[model samples]
Structure formats: C-alpha cells, structure tokens
Target: MTSISIRSNIQTEIREFLKLAIPLASAQVAQATTGFVDAVMMGWLGQEVLAAGGLATMIFMAMMMTGIGIISGVSPLVAEAYGAKQNRRVGQITRQGLWIALLLAIPGMMIIANLDGLMHQFGQAENIVTLADTYLNVMAWGLFPAIAFAVLRGCIVSLSEARPVMFIVVTATGFNIIGNYVLAFGKLGFPEMGIAGLAVASICAHWIMFLSLLGYMVWHKALRQYSLFKTLHRLEPKTMQQLLWVGGPIGITTLLEYGLFTTLTFFMGALGTPVLAAHQIVLQTLTVIYMVPLAMSYAATVRVGQWFGQRDWQQVRQAAFVSIGLAVMFLIVAAIALFTHSRQIIGLYLNLNDPANANVLNIGVSLMTVAAFGQVLDGVQRTANGVLQGLQDTRIPMLLGTFSYWGVGLTTSYFLGFHTDLAGTGIWLGSYIGIATAAIAFIWRFRGILSKKESRHPINGLTFKE
Candidate 1:
C-alpha cells in the first residue's frame, strides 16, 4: 500500500471509530446513571428497603436483559447492513426486532408479575420474600416500555446514531430520579410508598423513554435520509432468520450473565438480611461504574460489525483495541476513586440513625475494595466480548461466559464461602476468578480467530453457515 493509502485508511478508521464510540459512551453514561439513581433513591429507604430494592432490581435485570439480549442481535446486523449500504435490510431487521421484543415482553411481564410465589420457592426469609415480591409485581408493568425502548434504540445503533438514544435515556433517568424523590418520600403531597414508590417511578420513566425515542425516529429529518422511514414496508424471511440466529445467542448470553448475579442474590438472602443488604449496596455502586465499560463494549460491537461488513478486518481490530484501551483507562480512574474513598462512598448510602446496622455499611466498603480490580477486568472482558460479537463470532464467547460464570465463578464462590472461612468476601472472590478466566479465554479466542483469518489471505467476507 502507498503511504497515502495507508494514512487514509488510518484516518478513516479513527473517524469511524470515534463516530461510533462517542455516542455509545454517552448512551453508556446514561445507562450507568440510571443504576446510580435507582440505588441512591432506594438507599434513602433504610437498610431493609435498600436490600429489597436491590433484590427486586436483580429480578428486573434478569427479565429485561434476557429479552434485550435477543433484541441486541439487531445492532450488529444493522451495523453490518449499514456498512454494506443495504438500506432495506436495515429497516427489515429493525422491524423484526420490534416484533420479537413485543412477543418476548409478554412472558417477561408475566414472570415478573408472578415472581412472588417463585421467590418463596427459592426459600428466603419471609420478610425478604414479601418485599421482593411486592417490588417485582408492581415493577413488572415496566417490561412493555422498556422493551419498546430497546427495540427503537437497537435501530439507532444500526444507523450508528448514539446521541439521540443518549439524550432520551438521560432525560428519562432525570425524571425518574425526580419521581423517586416524590414517590419514595411522599413529597409534593404524595404517599410515602418506599420500595413500591421506586417501582412506580421506574415504570413512568420507562414510558417516557419509549415515547421520546419513538417520537425522535418519526420526526428526525436527518435520520430519514437513511431510508429509515421508507424501507419499513419490506421484510424478508431469510434476513429475519439471520437476525434470530445472531440475536438468539446474545439473548442467552445475557441471561447467563445476569442469571449468575440473580442466583447469587438468592443465596445471599439465605445467608442473612445483613449480608444481603450489604451486597446490594456494593452491587449498586458497581453497576453505576460499570456503564463506562458497557458503553465501550457497545462501541466495539458497532465498529467491529460495521468494519467486518465492509470487509475491513484491520479497521475492526483497530476499533477493538481503541475501545478496550479507553475502557481500561476509564475503569482505572473509577478504581482509584473506589479504593481511596470506599468508606465515604459507603457512608453516603448508610443510615446513620440505625447504629446497629453499621455492619452493613462497613462490610460494603470492605467488599467493594476487594471487588475493584475484578471490575476493571470486567470492563475488559465485556468490551472484548462485544468486539467478537460485532465480528459475528458469538459462539466461543458465549461458551466462555457460560463456563466462566457458572462453572468456575459461581462454584468457586460456593466452595470458598460455605466450605471455607472466607464468608461473604469469598463470594466476591468467585466473581473475580470467573471474570478473570473469561477475560483470558475471550482475548485468546478473539486473537486466535484474527490470526487464522490473517493466515488465509484474500478472504473478502465473513460467512457464518448457521
């Protein structure tokens, strides 16, 4: 390649990468903020309420992520089609994703609405079970709005338009926080419904987010040039099948990841209310900080998928590197903040009036410090996984995740915490081991794929038979 050709390619890759990354980062920030807001609001309701909110949130995550995972298949496919300049296919996949989301939400909402009986089956403290059930049932109605928003947002990702989704999420999260204040504390002449109030605020916020995204898609002229409106009439069965194939693994992958945490929560409840409460606080904090890496992963997925569609493997590699590098740097900063001020951060969520409950706050700070490095690794693995997914290399990473989370991680935690003297800290150790293993395996798999592909020159496109 000529010097100029090489320079041009580098510049184009950088520009494309940034075009995808900045918006994804913004969306990630909004997503992270939503978790932080949920925790902060719930924190105000005392230890029991905080614990209840956390448990309920886990169930919500499991249900939502399961369906959203399926819908996530739309992004890479859309990104690939957009890169290939296939306007009709982009529209078709987006439409199919929406339909799938609608169908998925029905069962999701039903499960949430009826989760109380299931919580009892898990065999938890009666009080904890009641609280979890109450919060889940009320919040179950949120599935529709949440799924709708994901469907629309996935379309935006396909088009590489991240800013609008970010705006919609940030605005809705802001309103949700305000609603939390009003509903949770009986402010503005409202009843102080505590955990239930938080659920109500969430449902209202999701509806707002859904409506806002739908409106933007309908009205934005700049977006219309991409044939987003005109191409909606065409739908192809083969293309729909491709969407399902790509999305199915992703849905299962997300369920596997979220399910690990939910299962952990179930176990935590059996340990005691104190441990459960402490874990919730730390989890909330972790979730907030996790948005940075999560955003980077999404960026990697979009950029990698697009480059793959364009048959630009070098650009895909560069995109993955840049995304991972940025994520590492971001998490390093978050780690420092956590390590230096763990106690202070925990204090913000702790109820000082209840001195007897100080153990919860103290344990949270200590456990969070132990969990910090793992969080950094988590950023890496997730972002790397996204890159692989973007390249349509999902099977290996999915298998890796399943093994790491279930085989290595959860099992280690059980053995260490119950069988040994590590107690709660041992549980966190399991996550670290699991994720670290996943990170190594994912990186190796991705690198191996890249190497094999490079050895076979003149390969023009990626073709997955299934």
Candidate 2:
C-alpha cells in the first residue's frame, strides 16, 4: 500500500475503534460505579463495615470472574460469525453461552453459601467473617442473573450493538444507588438491613439488568434477524463443548488475575484494620480507573475477532495496534490524574479530618501513589489480553499470566510484606512488577501472532476443536 493509503487506513481503523470503544468504556465505568457506590455507601456506615464489605466484595468478584471469563467466549465466537455473515451461528453461540452461565452459577452460589468455613480458614477476624458471610449469603443470589447478563452483553457487544447494554447498566447503577439508600439505611419506611441491604439492592439490580437486556435482544430491530429465541430448548453438544474449550482458559485467566488481588486483600487483612481499610480505599479508587482500559480491551476483542473472521490480516494488525495505542494513551492520562490528585482521591473514601481514620487515610494516599505508577502497565496488560482473545490465542496468555502474577508478583509481595520493612508498600510494588511482566509478555505474543501469514482456514487453525 502507498504511504497515503496506509495513513488513510490507519485513520479509518482508529475512528472505528473509538466508535465502539467510547460507549463500551462508558458502560464499564457505569458498571464499576455500582461497586464504587457500594463502597462509598458502606464507608459511611463505619470503618468496620468498609473493611468487612471490602473482603466480601473481593470474594464475590473472584467467583464472578470465573463466570465472566467463561461467558467471554461468546463475544469472540459471535463477533467472528457476524463478520462471516453466519447469523445463525451467532444465535446458537449466544444461547449456549446462557446455558454455560446457568451452569456456572450453580456451583458459584453453593460456594458462597458455604463461605463461612472458607473465610475462617483464611484467618479473618471472627466479627468481620460473620459480617462478610451475611453479605455474601444475600449477594449469592445475584450471581446467576449477573452472569446471564454478562453472556447477553458479550453477544450484543460482539455485534457492535453495545449502546443498549450501556443504557441498561447505567440504569441498573442508578437503581442500585437508590436501593442502597432505602434498604441499607431504612429510608422510605424500609427496614435497615446494613450490609445485607446492600446485597439485596445489588441482587435486584442484577435481575433488572438481565431482564432488560433479554427483552431488548428479543425485540430490538437490529437483532431481530438472528432469531436468538428459536433454539432455546435445544442443546447443542458441539457448540457447548466449543464454548468451554474457548471459555475455560479465559475463566482460568480471570481467576488467576483476580485471585492475585484477592490474595493481596488477605495479606492486607493480616497487617491490621487500618492497613486493610486503607488497602480497600486504594483498590476501590484504582478499580474505577481500570474500567477505561478494560472497556477498550473488550472493544479490541470484538474488532479483532471480526477482522480475523474476514481473513483481513492488515485490518487485524491495524485493529490490534490501534486498540493498544488508544488504551495506553488513555492510561497515561489516567495515571497523571491519579498521581496528581492522590490525596484528594483518597479523601473521597474516608474522612481525612478524623483522627481515628488518620492512619487509614495516610496509608490509602501512599498506596494511591503506587497505584498511579502502575496504572499504565495495568492498562497495557489488560488491553493486550483482550487483543489476544480477539485472535483466540488464550492458553499461552493464561500461562504467561500465571507466571507473572503468581510466580513473580505474589511471591514478591509475600516476601516484602512479611519479610521486609516495606510492608504494604512492598506488596503494592509487587503488583507493579507483575503487571509490567504480563504486559511485556502479552504485547510480544500479539506481535508474534500478527506477523504470521494468514492461513486459508484461519479460524480452524487458531481455535481448538472439541
């Protein structure tokens, strides 16, 4: 291609990526707002509530990650089918994805219901364990609906119809905030349920979002031709197997990443109440920012999968590069914002003026400083993971994550927090190193894959068979 043609192509790819990415990023931010709202509301309750709720949330997230990862298979599959103009396959994949969601939910609910023993095993304080258990019991009911919504979202986003999902999520977030106020604090004549009330509100919000998306898929004019409801009763063994083959690795990858963070939460709990509370504040703040790159990653997966299906090697490379470039640029901006306003950000989570919370506030501020430094690498790794998923290259990425997060990251965290004076700072620094390692590995993998010549049957070659 001539220089001008190449420049034009690059411009076109960037425009297309942004069109899909902006709405998706907004939806991610809206979805994350539910958790942010939860933390903020819980923070107002008391330090104990904040710490206990944070622990419970981590467990809930870890469990949900597996389901989200499994359901993630739907996006790539549907996107590829849509690109190939195989509309029937898209419907089939989406339906099976729902079944997978339901299947995953059963065990998830069971585990959370029996979480008391597990939390005790983790050596959490007795009172905090009881509070967390209370929260988890009610929150467990939301798992099925939440995972089901995720599957629907995957299908919709893959088709580049993300606006409805974004609308529903934002609406659900608003609903959740209102519910938290009414149920948690006895507003509008409702009985106050404390942490349990938050869980109840979350459950209600999950079901609402799920139902709203389901209705849209069934009635939306753009999705009408897919006939998504036609094969509701039929079970396709091959397709289900395909989803597991693709989604299982993704689930494991998510588990590994979330597990690392959850483990860090455990380490913080061991340090002290002040340290744990501070850790929660820092984590919540960073998670909200992380949503930006996370959304771009999802967009990258959809865009790359579509290009891959069409056997458009040049566009695939363009999409991958464009997505990564956009994610890094956004992260750079976010990191600077976080670094410059570290104290102000932490102040949102705690009362900085209160003497009792001084230690927590100070620790939180310091952790945010470390978080700012690592934000760019965090965005890079997450976006790279998305790019690889778009190409259906999952297993190797999973392996790389395992080594980086567990082997290097967690080990370093343990040594520093337990064996050295750095303590919490040391642990936070470990995450930076781990993320940087994964980022480098994932980017290398994407470039290696992109450089390969396209095969006649690209999908067959890249994807695993049942």
lDDT of 1 at 459: 63
Q: Against the true structure, what is every candidate's RMSD?
A: 2.5, 2.2
**Candidate 2, 1-466: lDDT as tens digits:** 8999999999998988887888888888987888888898888998889999999999998899789997888888888899889999999999998898999999999998888887777778888898899999999999999899989988998998878878888899899989988999999999999999999999999999999999999988878788887869888989999888878889999999999999999899888878988898889888888999999999999999998778687788889889999988888888889889988877777788989988987788788888986988999999999989988888899899999999989998999888998888889999778889999999999888776644433453354332
My TM-score estimates for the predictions, one after another, are 0.93, 0.97
Candidate 2 displacement at residue 460 in angstroms: 15
lDDT of 1 by residue, 273-322 (tens): 78888888788888877876887787788888887788776777778787
As a TM-score, model 1 comes out at: 0.93
Give model 2's TM-score versus the native structure: 0.97
